[model samples]
Target chain A: MKIEKTEHFLNFCCEMGRHLVQSGAEIYRVEDSITRLMHAYGYTDIEVFAIPSCIILNIMHEDHNYTKSIRIRSSAIALDKLDKLNNLCRRVCRETPDIDTCFAQLREITSAPLYSELVSYLAHGFVAVFFTLFWGGTALDAVIAFASGLAVKFANTTLGRMNTNIFFTNVCSSMLMASVPLALQYLGLNIHIDMIIIGAIMLLVPGIAITNVMRDMIAGDFLTAMSKLTEVLIISLALAIGIALPMGAARMFLGVM
Target chain B: MLRFLPCLYAFIACASFCYIFQVRKPRFIFLCSLNGAISWLVYLLTDFLPVEAARYFLATIAVSALAEILARALKAPATIFLVIGIIPLVPGGGLYYTMDYLISGDFAMFTAKGLQTAAAAGAIAAGASMVTSLVRMLTWRKQAHAQS
Candidate 1:
C-alpha cells in the first residue's frame, strides 16, 4: 500500500515537473523535494495521494521566476499550511493506525536555506577557474563541480516555488561541494588549481544569463530580464572584485613565491 | 599523453555545455581546440607577441574568426568556438597569483598581475566581440550579393 502511494506521488511529481517546465516556470527542486516529502509521510500508494498531495503542490506552484515581489502573507497562516499537510496525510492514510508513521515522517522532510543556493552557481565558476590554474585539478573535476553548481543554482532559484517544507536539493549541492577537495586529492593532482576550478565552476552559470539576455532582447522584455541581468552582472563584478582585491592587496604587501 | 588531454577535454566540455544552452555552435569545438593549441603555441613563441599583452587577445581573434567560419559552414554555435578556443587563455593562474599574494600579503605582485589579468580578459572579450560582428557583417554582405 505504501509502495503504491510512493509510486503515485513520484508519477505526480514528474508530470507536475514537465508541466511546470512547459508553463515556463523554472521548477528545479520541486520534484525531489516533493518525493522526499511523500517518502517521509510513508504514503506510498496512488489512492492515498489523490487530493492532499495535489493541494500542497498546487499551493506551492502558484508563484515563481518573473521576479515579482513575493507577497508577505501572514505567518499565522503557517499552521494553516501545516494543518493542510497533516489533514492531507490523515485523509490519505485512511484509518491506518500507528500515527507513528505520520509523525516520524514529518521529522524526515528536509529543505534548504535560500542565500546559499543563490550564490552556488557563481561560486562554482569562480572555483572552476581557480582550480584549473593554481591547484592543478583536471577537466573531470571541473565538469562535475559545474554541473553540481548548476543543479544547486536551479534549486536555489526555484526552491521557493516547490514547497519550502522539503529541502533535499540544498543538501545534495553541499555534499557535492564537500566532495571537491577529496576528488582532487584522490587523483594526486596539485590541490590549488584542482580544488579552485571545482569551486569556481560551482558558481559559473554564465550561459543562463547570456541566453536569457538574448531571449529577452529578441522577445522584447527589454527593461526586465536585461536590466536584471545588468544588476546581476554588477553583483558578479562586485563578487569578483571582492575575491581579487583582497588577494591583490595582500600580494602588494607581501612577497611572491 | 592524458595530461594535456584534460585541458583539451575541459575546453570541449565547456564549449559543448554552452552549445546545449545554444550559446554557440558545436563545430566551435574544433575551432576552440585549434585556437587553444595556437595560443599555447603563441605563448611558447615570445618573439612576435609579448606574453604581457598581445598573447591572450590576439590568439582569441584568430580562433573566433576561424570558429565563425566553421560555425557558418556547419550551421552551429559561434560562441561555442570562441569559448572553447579561449579556454586555454583563461588566466586561471593569474587569478591564483593574485589570491596567493593577497593571502601572503604581497601587494606589489598582486597589483601587477591583477591589472594584467583584468586587462587580458577585457582585451579578449572586446576583440572576440568585434571579430564576431565583423564575421557576421562579411557573411551577410556575401549573402546579399549572392542574392542579387
Candidate 2:
C-alpha cells in the first residue's frame, strides 16, 4: 500500500510535530522544526501552529492545500527523546530521506528505551540524599532522605504504571515522603526531620512545569504558557496538600512532635 | 575548599536527577551537572549579599546564560540543562517550611516563609526570562544581519 507523496510528507511532518510536543519540546521549537522540515522537503507555503497539546499544519502544493490537526493530550519530560527528535529533524533536512525510512526512524526514536526502573529509583534516592547534603544535613539526615526518596520513587513509579491521576499520585507519594521523617522522629533517632522531608519532597517538586511555563512565555507561546502555568499551580498545590495531610495527622495523633 | 563540598553535592544531585530524566549521553550529563554546580556555587558565593532574593536571581541568570551558550554549541535545547541545573537554587526548603508552619498553625512564620518562597520563585522566573529574552534578541539581530 503506497500513499501519495504529499500525503506521506504531511503525515511524517505531523507525526514529528506531535512527538516533539509530547516529549515536552517548547512550542516555538516544535513549530520551527516542522516548518523547517517542510521547507526542506520542497514545500514553499506552509503554516504551522502548535500549542502545548495540539499542532495544526497547512501545506500548500500545486494549487491544493493540505491541513492536518494533531491532538496530543499527555506529555512527560524526556530530554533524550527531545534531543533525538531534534537530531532527526536536522538529518531529514540535510539528507531528505525517503518518507518510509523517515517514518521508520521516527518510530525508532519514539520507541527508544528509557532508563531501567532500578536506575530511576537509585537516581532519585541519590539525588534526594545529595540535596540533603547540599542543605547542610548530617549523614543520618541524608540516609533518612535516601530511604524516603526510594520509597517515594517506588510509589511514584508504581502509580505511574497504574495510570493513576497525577494529583492523586502526587498526594499519595508526598504523604508517604513527608511521613518518613516523622516516623523516624517517632522512633527517637534524633535527626533533623525537616531536612529529610524537604530533601525527599524535592524529588516531587514541579521544576519542569515551572521552567517550561516561563520558557513557553518567553518564546511568545502564551497559550501553552497559561496551560503550563495551571499545571504548575495544580502540582504545587497537590504537593502542599500532600505534605500537609501526614503532618496534620501526625500532630493530631502524636500531639506535636 | 570547604565551600566547594556543597557545590560538588549539588553537581551530584543534578546528575542524579538528570539520569532519572534519562539524559543518556555522558557528555550531556556532565555538562548539565557542571552547569548545576556552577549555578549553585554562584548562589553560595552571593549569600553574603544583602538581599536573599538576589541570590536566586543572580544564580539563575548565570545558569540560563550558560545553558543558552551550551545549547547553541551542542545544538540541544537549552532546557535539557536549564530545568535540572536550576533545581539546586529552587526554594524547596522555603516551600517545606511554609507548609510546615501553615500546618502547625503558625501564621506568622507561615506568612514569612511563604513570602520568601514566592520571592525566590519569582526571582528564578525573572532571571531565566531575562536571560532568555536577551539571547532571543541577540539571535534575532544576528538572523536579521545575515539576511541583509
Candidate 3:
C-alpha cells in the first residue's frame, strides 16, 4: 500500500476504535475489535491500546509504520449503538469491504437514532413503579415513585441537552429523586416516602459502572478498572450529596423532625 | 398473586431498562428481560434459605452465568443483560435504611444497616466475579486446546 493510503487506512482504523471506546465498549473489546479490523484489511502487524477515554494504535504496512491516536469523550452505555459497531467489525472481518464503504457503514452506526425521549421517559417511569412494587411498597408509593422518575428523567434529558457536566447532571437528577417524594409526603399523602425514594434512587445507582469495574479488573485492565471505580464512587457520592441537601433543608425549614 | 408480583415487577424493570439502554433488537429485549426475571425468581425461591446473604450470592451467580451464555449465543455483550438483570438483587433497600438511620442519628441502627448493605454488595460482587473468572478460564482452555 502507498504511504498515503496506509495513513488513510490507519485513520479509518482509529476512527472505528474511537467510536467503540467513546460509546462505552470495554477496553479489551475495543482493542480486540481494532486489531481484528486491521488484520482483516490485510495489515499483518498491528498493536492497539484503548482505555475508556482514548485509543492509540500502530500498524505496519509495506515496510512502513503508521501510528494514530484518537481522543474520545466518554459516553453512556448504548447497547444498540455498541451492537451496531460490533456488527460492523464482524462484517469487515468477513467481507473486507473498501475503505469508503466501511467509512459509510461506520457513520451509519454512529448516527443512528436512539430510542425516542418519550420512550426513555416511559421506561424510567416503569422502572420506578416496578421497583417500588418489588421493594414491598404500596400502590401509593408506586405512584409517588413514578412521578419522581419522570422528574428525574426530565432533569437528565434537558440538562444533558444543555451540555452540563455529568456530575452536575447526576446530582440534579438524584436531587429530584430524593426530594419529589419527600415534598409530596409533606403535602399530606399517606405513602411510604422512604420506599418511593429508594425505588427512584435505584434508577440512578450506577449498576453498570460497578459491574464494569469488576469485569475490567478480572480482565486484567487495571487502569480502566481504577478509572471506572472512581466513576462509580463519584456517582454514589453525588447521589448521597444530592439526597442529603434536600433532606437537610427540609429538616430545618419545614421542621420535619 | 401476591407471591408472583416480585417476578412480574422484575420483568417490567428489566424490560424497561432494555428500552432505556436503546436495545435495537426487540428479541434481545425479551431474552434479556427473561434473564432478569429468572434471576429474581431464583432470589425469591431461595428465601427460605437460612443465610440471607447466601441467597443473593446464588442469585447473582445465576445471573452472571446466564448472561455469559446469552452473550455468546446472541453475539452481544453480556454486560447489557447482566447489569439490568442484577438490579433486583442490589441492596437498594439496605442502602435506604442505612441512610434513614444515619439521618435520624441512630448510630447503632446506622452501623447495622450499613454493614448489611456492604455484605449484600459484597455477595453480589463475589458471585459475579467468580462466574466471570470461570468463563475466562474455560475460554482460555479452549484457546490452548486449539493452539495445541
Query: Residue by residue across B27-123, what tens digits does model 3's lDDT show?
Result: 8888888888988899889988987789989999999999999999988877777877888887777877777777778999999888887787778
Query: Which candidate order results from sorting by DockQ in descending order?
Result: 2, 3, 1
Tens-place lDDT per residue, model 1, A135-216, is 3555555555555445445654465466542224333333344344434444564444335433443243232333334333
lDDT of 3 by residue, A1-257 (tens): 46576787788888888887766688878888888888887888888888888788898777888888877775877888888888889988999878889889889888899888889999999899999988889998998888988988998888988998778888999888888877876777778877787888888888677767777888889999998888887887787778777887877788653
lDDT tens readout by residue for model 2, A182-232? 888877788998888778878988876776778778888999999889878
Task: Determine which window of 10 residues in candidate 2 chain A has minimal summed lDDT.
Answer: A207-216
**lDDT digits (tens) for residues B100-126 of candidate 2:** 899889999999999999898888988
The residue-level lDDT of candidate 1 at B101 comes to: 61
Identify the runs in model 1 with alpha carbons over 4 angstroms from their true place: A1-190, A193-257, B1-48, B99-105, B143-148
Best by DockQ: 2
Candidate 2: stretches off by over 4 Å: none
Residue A133 local lDDT, model 2: 89
Give per-residue lDDT, candidate 2, residue B55.
93
